[model samples]
Target: QVYVNGELIGGCDITLEMFERGELQPLVEAAVKVQEGNQQA
Candidate 1:
């Protein structure tokens, strides 16, 4: 299973699909950025 921002993203196949389309990195980066900002606050 996979999740982002507490939302479901699905399992390994779906995750691989996102990675293949080059969406995973930016999604992870944005999630990290939000987490960082939340920590700062």
Candidate 2:
């Protein structure tokens, strides 16, 4: 499984699929935005 900042994002299978489709970057960027928002809160 894959965890980002202790939250489970997905398992290896889904992660690999996202990478292959070039969708991982947006997901990562969104996650970063969420983290930044939380920090400002």
Candidate 3:
């Protein structure tokens, strides 16, 4: 799932293991992009 400031942005299904692995940099980057978009608007 994607989120911005507690709002849901996008959603997907994934394994709990993958989520627990802490592989969140890409997701964080995406969230940053969303935040930037919101800021620009």
Candidate 4:
């Protein structure tokens, strides 16, 4: 299973689908940005 920020993203197939659709990177980037913002707060 894949997770981000304690939220379940999905299993391998769903993650692969998102990668194929060019979504995963942006999602990860957004998640990282949010985490960084939280850290700075």
Enumerate clash totals for all models, in the order shown.
Answer: 0, 0, 0, 0
C-alpha lDDT of all candidate models, in order: 0.91, 0.83, 0.62, 0.93
List, residue by residue over 1-41, the lDDT tens digit for candidate 1.
Answer: 99987778889999999999998889989899999999999
Number of colliding residue pairs in model 3? 0
User: What is the Å distance of residue 19 in model 1 from its true position?
Assistant: 0.3
Error of 2 at 21 (Å): 0.2
Give the lDDT of residue 31 in candidate 2: 84
In candidate 3, what are the lDDT values of residues 1-41, reduced to their tens digit?
76555755455544344356665556667788988999999
**Could you tell which candidate, 2 or 4, scores higher by TM-score?**
4
Error of 2 at 33 (Å): 0.5
Model 4 lDDT tens row, 2-25: 997778999999999999999999
lDDT of 2 at 6: 64
Q: Which residue pairs in candidate 3 have backbone atoms (N, alpha carbon, C) closer than 3 angstroms, thus clashing?
A: none
What digit string (tens of lDDT, one per residue) describes model 2 on residues 1-41?
88765667699998899889997778788889989999999
Candidate 4 Cα deviation (angstroms), residue 5 = 2.1
Best by lDDT: 4
Which number leads on TM-score?
A: 1
